[model samples]
Target: MTFFLQNFFNGIMLGGLYALIAVGYSMVYGILRLINFAHGDVMMMGVYFAYYSAVVFSLNPILSFTVAVLGAAALGFLIDRVAYKPLRKAPRISALITAIGVSFFLENLAVVIFGAIPKSFLDVFKDKSILEKTITVADARIPLLTFLVIIVTFAMFSVLFFVVYKTKIGMAMRAIAADIPTTSLMGVNVDNVIGFTFALGSALAAAGGIMWAMRFPNVHPYMGFVPGLKAFIAAVFGGIGSISGAVLGGILLGMIEIFLAAYFPSVMGYRDAFAFIILITVLLVKPSGLLGKKAIEKV
Candidate 1:
């Protein structure tokens, strides 16, 4: 039971990260119906931005993390304006290809600038209360970081929930989601609403990237690739375009991967494949996901 608790705790920690990243995927898909392949790269940029802000500028780590998240928010808006906005009227295929192109561009651009080597971000986790403290569960000691992740995630969810359903801006976003043309006709600035959605999603991704790097203690140009893809899979599992679904899916996926690796030591090497396998199962079993609403097409 203690062993199960330990692995479960680890899975929750990982799920927090996955849920944040999955939010970005769900938001973009909900708005544009286009998967921003570059979303993960945006997270990578945030990691580096925070890294340099701490190491080069010698700023406080917390302050650097804030700057990194803000920078990533700005980057999200920039990507939409520069790459996606132009193709707004273009075919969905065009936007998808462009998203892919942007993904590669960010990855290659990072390689040119930051090189292929991974940088250490151990200091980001050092000297922090959350990192230093641990609580004993029977015989197992659980890191405070796990609880920190959960607390932060729920806090973020609250904020996002309010922003999406309560605010006037959120109303506009929902309006756009319902029908962009109708929303535009209602005098809502579709562009601005979309931009804000991107910004919000990107900010969350940045936060996830920072947390991920702090836990993993390394940053590389391609670091966000796997997490991004896995998060995307999580989004799908939870039902793409559904916010709550994304979170639920991410948590379940994380738990599955962690527990699978823990209980099935022989298949540990194939842990990554488990996400896709689950994705396939979900696609076959329940395409709309656990909480997703099935769409009705008028014939």
Candidate 2:
């Protein structure tokens, strides 16, 4: 029972990070029907930004995190403006290839500057004081960080829900997702909305990247690769284009992966295998996703 609890918490914590990235993917797909493949790399850049700000400029961790998120948002905006915007009316494949190119470009850029060596945050700032001690409830000892991750995940979702459901921008975003042509005809600034979508998604990914760095204690140019894949899977599993579904999928995927890693040592070598399996299973059983609505083709 304790083992189960421990694994469960671990999964939820891991899910928080995945959900953050997944939200970005789903949001972009929802709005533009385009997968921003560069998003994961955007997350990679965020961690680097936080790391550089903290280690070199001696900034506070909170400030460092803030700067990382803002920096990512700005970068996201730039990417959309420079790469995606001009190709809006081009072939879908063209935009997708461009996204892939952007992803590779940012990753190689990081390699050139940060090198291939994996770096850790030098000074522990935020979340550093989380007690190392674990409380044994029954046979299981639960770590403080586990609880903190769960709380943070929930809080983030609550805020996200409010912003999406209650705000005017959120309404506009949803309208655009439902029908871009109609929304544009209705006088909505489709381009600006799309840019904002990228910025918001990238910002969330940045936050997740920093929190993930805290948990894993390592950052590399390619670190985002696996996590990015898992998050994308999670987004699809829950329901691509559905905010609630993304969150749900992320948490569920996290739990499953952590449990497998914890209980199955040998299988842990294939840590991401379960994510792909889940993606396939979800697609076969419910292609629209666990929480996604069936998309109808308009003739």
Candidate 3:
């Protein structure tokens, strides 16, 4: 029972992180129907931003995170204006290819700039001792960082829910998602809303990336690739366009991955393949996903 509880807690922590990144994928897909393959690279850039902010600029944690999030948000906005906006009227295939190009561009740019080596994230903190603290609950040792990650994830999601459901800007976002042409006809600044969506999604990805580095204690140029892919799977699994669905999918995927590795140690090496298997199952069984509504195109 103690062992089970430990894994469960770990699963929750991992799930929270995945959900954070998944929300980025879901929001972008919901608004633009574009995959934004560069989303993960944006996250990688965020980690680097925080790393340099702390190590080079000598900023504290609060300032480091602020710079990283804002910088990533700006990057997302710039990507849209530069790469995607021109192809907005072009075939979606063009946009999709462009997203891939942007992803590769960011990855290689990081390699050129940050080098191909991994850095320790914890070493940048002045008081790393606080993060290393642990609490024992029913014979399970849980790190304070785990609790912090979970709490932050919940708080961030709360803010996201409020923005998406309660605010006027959110209403405009929903309107655009429902019918971009009709929303433009209604006098909404469609381009601004879309840009805002990208910024918002990228900001969330940056937050997730920061928390992820904290948990894993490593920062590398390619670190975001696998997690980004997994988050995309989670978005599709839970219903790509639904925020709540992304959360659900992320948590479920995290739990499954943790439990499968825990119980079947021999299959640990093949764990990554399991995500692909799940993706295939979801597509085969329900193309609209668990919570996604079937999109009907008006001919």
Q: Give the best candidate by lDDT.
A: 3
Query: Per-residue error at 238 for model 2, in Å?
Result: 0.5
- What is the descending lDDT order? 3, 1, 2
lDDT tens digits, residues 32-137, model 3? Answer: 8899889889999999999999999999988999999999999999999999999878999999999999999999999999999888998669999977788999
Candidate achieving higher lDDT, 2 or 3: 3
Q: Tell me the tens digit of each residue's lDDT in model 2 across 38-71.
A: 8889999999999999988889888999999999
Model 2: how far residue 240 lies from native, Å: 0.8
Candidate 1 residue pairs in clash (backbone atoms < 3 Å): none
Q: Where is the poorest 10-residue window by lDDT in model 1?
A: 123-132
TM-score of each: 0.95, 0.92, 0.96
**Mind sharing the TM-score for model 1?**
0.95
| lDDT agreement with native, every candidate | 0.87, 0.84, 0.89
lDDT of candidate model 1 versus the reference: 0.87
State the displacement of the C-alpha of residue 121, model 1, in Å, after optimal TM-score superposition: 1.1
Candidate 2 lDDT trough over 10 residues, lowest sum: 122-131
Stretches > 4 Å off in candidate 3: 297-299
Q: Would you list the clashing residue pairs of candidate 3?
A: none
